[model samples]
Target: MSESIDIVYEALGRYIDGLCGSTYIGTARGMVVLYRGAEIHHLTPLKEPLPFLNLFYRKGTVEIVGVWREEKSEAFFLRAAAADVRLFEDERTISIITYPRTGDMQERGMLIITLHANMGMAKTLKSIIQEETRFIKKEEVVISSRVSI
Candidate 1:
């Protein structure tokens, strides 16, 4: 069964695209990774300025966060938007880059996922994130009244 475990990753690709359906699968280390095709953004340095001159460290994890739409758990209620979901990170050192979370946090924090994947896989992931980052206008209307003297 271990030798055939490759299906897990394959399922993940399809799952993100809605082709895999509801049942979720965890990684070898007991964690499930997910993404929203409509909420990713390519953050510029203005928001996350490259603080200091790097002497050695270079590679970093790709960060993402949103309403969790995953397995059932207690953390679901913590998310302000949807009571049914919450975001989290696994202990996989090579895959996720997480930082300390603090205070009365309602929103699920970043995922810091990896982009150092195969070209096809990386592109698929990138596309999902990119599509969501596109700007779409929303219309708003305001009402006003005039007073007669």
Candidate 2:
């Protein structure tokens, strides 16, 4: 795990704590902490060198998305539908989106986590796709910015 990943995990832990208010069980990996299982805090602890984005919620499910740079190209990771991942690079910043299961989305109690290096870019991306999909519906987006520690 890298220092960046540790920082991101700490931030995520704080966010999760605020929402669910439940004690979290996290798996430590070097400097990174990967959320272990279906547990909110254990769901996704990034490995390393990945920046924070934001969380989004649609209907009842939660989604976590983030963008990072690898080999000079933007890499996108979506913790949705088995983690939909992608990569991109250009004048615009990269974006990633994850949707929850259909049943969960319809429940309107899910939470979505979206992370990115740029807050403005993340927000714009979220607004653009907020209604374009139903993978995760009736949920809220938790937005977080990435910073070097």
Candidate 3:
């Protein structure tokens, strides 16, 4: 049997809107890439970002963290919000795959995610995503994030 996957696209779009001087979150769906090996995958049949955000939201706040690319362990906790999640040569992308503390069979397949930003906001968003480049494992990474910077 093939399992269904819930994809996140709009929240990141909204977040990008917020960054782009929009008072309201626009309807544009954010750009996200999911891939296996060198073949990029598309996220079809789009869904709202609320359900996905709800998974990590707590106490009226949600924390975004980046997992070290070399980490092979399947178990982990959301210890803290990462200062930056960018893990690509292109400054516009931010990796969003985090390791869960429990290896729930149901919560499978967050393998690789990288978010690409709009070219216009590249300068503004780059600083927020800036981090040490050595931690990035580009060749094997799949990326996802807001569509800014």
What local lDDT score does residue 5 receive in model 2, on the 0 to 100 scale?
A: 60
What's the TM-score of each model vs. the native? 0.23, 0.25, 0.27
Clashes of each: 0, 34, 10
Q: Write the per-residue lDDT of candidate 1 for residues 1-149, one digit (tens) a residue.
A: 43223333332333343222322112111121222234432211112222111011001112121111222110100001111112222332224323213222433233233322234433333343344333332221111011000
**Deviation in angstroms for 12 in model 2?**
24
Best by TM-score: 3
Sorting all predicted structures by lDDT, with the top scorer first, yields: 2, 3, 1
Worst lDDT run of 10 residues, candidate 1, spans 73-82
Candidate 2 stretches greater than 4 Å from native:
1-38, 46-48, 51-99, 102-111, 130-149
| Model 1 root mean square deviation, Cα atoms | 19.3
Error of 2 at 113 (Å): 2.0
Better of 1 and 3 by lDDT: 3
Relative to the true structure, candidate 2 reaches a TM of 0.25
Q: Is candidate 2 or candidate 3 better by TM-score?
A: 3
